[model samples]
Target chain A: MSALLEVRDLTVRLRVGGSDREVITGTTLEIAEGEAMGLVGESGSGKSMTAKAIARLLPAGAGVEGSVHFAGTDVLALSGADLRRHRAKVAVVFQDPRAHINPVRRIEDFMTESLRTLEDVPRAQARTRAADALEEVGIDDPARRLRQFPHELSGGMLQRVMIATALLSRPLLLLADECTTALDVTTQAEVMAILDDLRRDRGLSMLFITHDLELAGAVCDRTSVMYAGQVVETSAADRLHADPLHPYSAALVQARPDVTSTAERLVAIPGRPVSAFEAPSGCRFAPRCPHALDSCRSTEQVLTGLDAGRVRCERAATLRGRLLDPTESPTESEETADA
Target chain B: MPDADGPVLSVSGLRKVFGTQVAVDDMSFDLAPGRSLAIVGESGSGKTTVARMVVGLERPTAGTIVACGRDRSRPARNAGERTRRGREVQIVFQDPYSSLDPRQSGAAAVDEVLRVHHDHDAATRRRIVGELADLVGLDSRQMSALPRALSGGQRQRVAIARALATEPKVLILDESVAALDVSIQAQVLNVLADIRDERGISYVLISHDLAVVRQLTEDVLVMQRGVVVERGRTTDVLDEPQHPYTQRLRASVPGPGWKPTRTLRRPA
Candidate 1:
């Protein structure tokens, strides 16, 4: 099966204080046709950059070096009108709906503009199509919603509008960047349901970026864990949850709050993710990893397995017990347990 | 419902209004010392408004807030006297990045509190900020860096450290961990738990995530449009939610086991 979108050795740089700073470091992945891939990491781990790069929407200060191929076309090679049209192939849904939807514009305009570039329908037809899209996404009173301002609608409704707009273009690929994080859980679940239904029906491939592991597990078929802008591991969501191959991925699993688990206290990763500018020497997560050893500090690893989507972490296999390291506790770590 | 141990903070029939819109109405809950009470609500349900009122940011149109046996304590009004109330209840905001003044460095920001609130001189203030930063897992080197330089987790940790500067009795976290990454969310939640155990500080944790609330808080309060819809043990509310709103909230948590292909019927 051919991939809907394949990204190769993507590296993005930006000028910071007279020196170039690398945002994405040799990041690579692919989204299969009609598949969902979850890109997850802490902030500044280059998740959003990868999405922006795919959309060809990097800001003016950014410099890029990589190849993103979609539908038999080298995305980077597209020129003039071709590039703009190619850019529309993969639509992006941002973290906050307010950020993407114009606060000044009405719902009617947002829906119309989304389709204007992608389709050549009559104005009356477009309005009817917009109302239909809104209804399809489960918006109540679709006609009333069209005239309302962005602020007048709930965050969930605004997001529905964003999704409705994305679907208006009928793109094969969609990029949702923490799009549900800002919403309440009830609304998030509703939005998730809509996305799941839409994907199956429309055969939409998604590159879903979030810092939430639970959400990734629930919504994604496969997940790629990133740390310091590198894809640490990518595997089936359930497999990753059960047996994470990378040290960072393992820690994230233990940290997720599960309703089934009766653990007395929530486990916390001891240290913060490494600074993006000063990437960790060997493994990006080595400094904070409980399984970190002398061998991990000197040897850098890369993606080694295509069969099961495994990582090159030298300590991953042998570091099993220490992955959670039940005994090891940072000094102030226990003070909160009793609370 | 009042208990034998007595509540450090108690609210009853709390109501708030913005013109014709009732942001919060008839909210009631009790916070015991060293205990954490999670307030879970949907957006526009008045969870933050309740917190703001408890912290005295907004005056309550009705109801009473009794703190440490005083029927109602004076709210934080001006910069000069705000520190006095800061010792009673300190609030941790959602966005740590914007919460701090951009002009001041991390250390300088923490030190400012010490200088103004703690009545410490420049030298002492700097030292105190170093201790605070270290307490929240931040290094002294980060003291000179601006808020923009730190990661989301680090910035939020800085916010936590600043909240602890006055040694507040009740720490009110309003979507404190919501903006953080999942891994960082657990880390910060741990920090909050540690603070409560070490200092016997009570917490008024406000969130919309039921799983997170169940993990950290023992007691829970479910709010709907400012009204206390349900109140009980966190496990009780999560495991067997009695209120319709509470049940819906619990069902709403997205996880691998549950298929994200069903939507609950809209509230009638």
Candidate 2:
């Protein structure tokens, strides 16, 4: 089957002062039909930028290079009615629902406005479809909820309403950019489940962007680890977590706290996360990686295909089998030896 | 400062109401010296309100707060008494960006705390500020830099250092590490654990993240809708939760092999 979305050699440059600064540098990704791809990275890593570029939501004065093809159509070249249709087909749900939703507007008005105005659906039909979407997301009393304002609902409920609105358009591609990050853990789990179920039922392709590696691993079929505005590793979510090849990916996995296991100290990744502007000439993670060599500092590494995945590291071959899974518990003797 | 009979911090029947809404209802907990307690709850669960009451930011509707062997059920009568109360327990709030003054350097922020609590010479204040900076893992460069110049983790370090400047018996971390990234959060958590071990200070942690609670605290109190649904040793409560709310909270945390499920079944 053909890919639903293909982004190749995409670079985003913003007008900073007099010179242009690159925010995303040569990022290539593809989402197969009905496939969910997860993008995991820290702040300023271009995860959101990638999503925005695909959706053509970049801020004014930003320059976008390369191509974004959605279902064999060039998304960047679309204009007028074509662009509008493309946008409707690709729905995005951001982190904060309150920010996206108007405070004074009723839920029904917000949900049905896009369908009625853009798609030329009548008011009554729009309302009926909106109610069905809300019911699909497990929200009861859709009529009463439709009359309520954003402030009347809790954060979780507001997020559910947002998801319902996204589904109202029956989007072929869903861009969830940290949509669950602002929610509580239980609510996050519930929302994730709804998204998972909806994707399966509708055969929707998803671009799941988040700062959480574990969450991405759980929900996405494949995961891409981004660092300094570039994808450093790409692998099956389960394989990536079980044994990450890139040193940066290994460090990030080790940095997260595990609720089931008790470790005396978390293995912190050294040095602060760098932005694209401050990224080094060579490997972006060389400064913080423990196993960085002289070549890593001066030589830029491109993504190389491995047995089951791709990694952008100079020493991935040599370091294979030596990297231990961070989630696994070390033996008592090993723990004591380290201590 | 060790009290064999009494806890370092204690609360009894704590309650807070905002006009018609009950923010916190009949909440109670205690923290012994050199121990830490975690209050886990979702937003609007009254965990933050409890912290605010303990820090004197909010006057409790009813209940008593005993900190460092003194009852602070009511607001302090005078500035001197307020300062005395402040010297006993200090709080670090969630957002490091807004909690800190944008113009003040980290060194200056810590120095101001020393000025209020300690009547020391300029040289002594400078020495103490440097020591506090070092304790929180802030380098000299970062200490001299303003809050805006530092990253979220660095700003949080300055905030922690300022809180420790008072030499309080108890520290209240109200979602202190929530705003940080995972890597930076780990670094800050380690700094907090080191402080607890070296200084023997008690801690009251308010957070929604169960993993952080499991890592940093010994005792856990799970709150839902302003009520304490469960309380016990952290491992016991997390491993085998008796309350339905606690079970849902424990299961909600995503880990290896975790799959999202339905929302918690509403209690009858």
Candidate 3:
């Protein structure tokens, strides 16, 4: 299957403090038609920046290199009406819905404004469509909900409203950037289910970005791990969870506190995570990686193909299975036995 | 002195009414010395209200809060009494930045807390501040930098250090590690566990993340709509939750082989 969205050798340089800093360096990824790709990374890893670059939402004084191709169109080169139309084909749902929506506006006006302004739909027809969209997101009494203000709705409800509004344009790709991270766990599950169903029902492609590895794995078919503005590994979500090829991916998996069982102490990554601009020369993750070699720090890391995906580490072959080594701990075994 | 075997903190028949709406209704729990208890609930479940009442941020409509064998149900009589109560319990909020001053460095913040609570000499205050910074894993450089110069995790460590400056017996962690990244959260959790073991201090963790609750707390209280639906040992409550709300909450956490299924019933 051909890719619906292709980002090739994308580099973004942001002008910070009177100097340009490379925020995203040589990052590349693709999303096929109707495929959900998870972009997993820590803060400053450039996952969100990559999304903004693809959506042509970069800030002023930002310089870009490389191409973003969407449905046979150069997204970076789109201008005038073409850019506006391209924006309509791609929608983004942010982490906090409250920050994005106007507080003074009613749900009716907020939901129907895009249709009336962009497509020149009649007010009554747009209101009816907005109500129908609200119902589709499982909100009951859509007419009543549409009459209420943003503050009148709960966080989960407002997030659903945001999703409903995003679908108003019938976009082909949804950039769900931590849309559910701010919600409660049960609400997150419900919202995630709604998003998954919508994607499948509408044959919509998605670029799901989150700091949660397990959440992305559960919802996305493919997962790509980003480190310091570079694509470190991409594989089937379950494969990445069960057997991650990259060392950083393995450490992240080991670092999280497990719900099913308890350990004496989580295997904490020694150093703090660094942004793309602050990353070291050869490998961004080498400083924190436990299995780093002398050569790993001296040479430039490149993505090497393995099966259906790609990994950046040169010693991924030798470090397989050993990356997630269980340290000797009597507390872990005792807890497991108790469970 | 309080009995060694008694609970460090205890509350009974706690209730809070905001005008006509009852935010928390008839809640009760105990925190034994050196033990950790978690109040698990979603937004609007009144878990935060319960914490607020216990910490004297909100006056309860009807209840009794006793910490270290002293009743603090009513407002403190004077500034000295309030300071004594503060020494019994300290809280760490979710957003560390909001709790910290932007202009204050980590060491300066901790020093301010020490100065307010004790009449230590300047040299003693500095020494104590250094100890607090080291306890929270902040180096001398990070301790000297302002809040803006630190990362989110580093700022949170500074908050933890400030909270510990009072040498309180009970720490109320209200979603303390929720704002941090997973790796940073792990480091913080380890730090907390070590502190608990070393100081024999009690913890009351208010959180919605079940995984974090399981890792940090010994006892768990599952709340919904201002009522406690389930309460037991953390392992027993989480591993074998009887209440439907608790079961749904446990199932909601995504992990290996987990699949999200939509439920039509709205929680709030």
Candidate 1 lDDT tens digits, B1-268? 2343788898888888999999988877778888989998988889999899888889888888877655553454566556566567789999987898777777777776666567777777777777777667788777677888877888888888888887777889998988877778888877777777778988888988777787778898888876788989888778899999888888777666876645633212
Interface RMSDs of the predictions, in order, are 3.4, 3.2, 2.8
Candidate 1 residues lying further than 4 Å off, grouped into runs, are: A259-262, A320-339, B1-5, B73-83, B103-134, B143-149, B264-268
Candidate RMSDs in order: 4.9, 3.5, 4.3
Q: Whole-model lDDT, candidate 3?
A: 0.90
Q: List the residue pairs that clash in candidate 1.
A: A335-B194, A336-B193, A336-B194, B24-B226
Model 2 Cα lDDT, one tens digit per residue, B131-238: 888889988999999888999999999999999999999999999999998889989999999999999999999999888898899999999999999999998998
Off by over 4 Å in 2: A325-339, B1-5, B264-268
lDDT of each: 0.80, 0.90, 0.90
For the second chain of model 3, what is the TM-score against the true structure's chain B? 0.97
Worst 10-residue lDDT window, candidate 2 chain A: A329-338
Tell me the deviation in Å of residue B158 in model 2.
0.4
Q: After superposition, how far is residue B223 of candidate 2 from its true place, in Å?
A: 0.5
Q: On a 0 to 1 TM-score scale, where does candidate 1 land against the true structure?
A: 0.90
Model 2 residue A208 CA deviation in Å: 0.7
Q: Write the per-residue lDDT of candidate 2 for residues A186-245, one digit (tens) a residue.
A: 899999999998888899999999999989999999999999889889899988888888
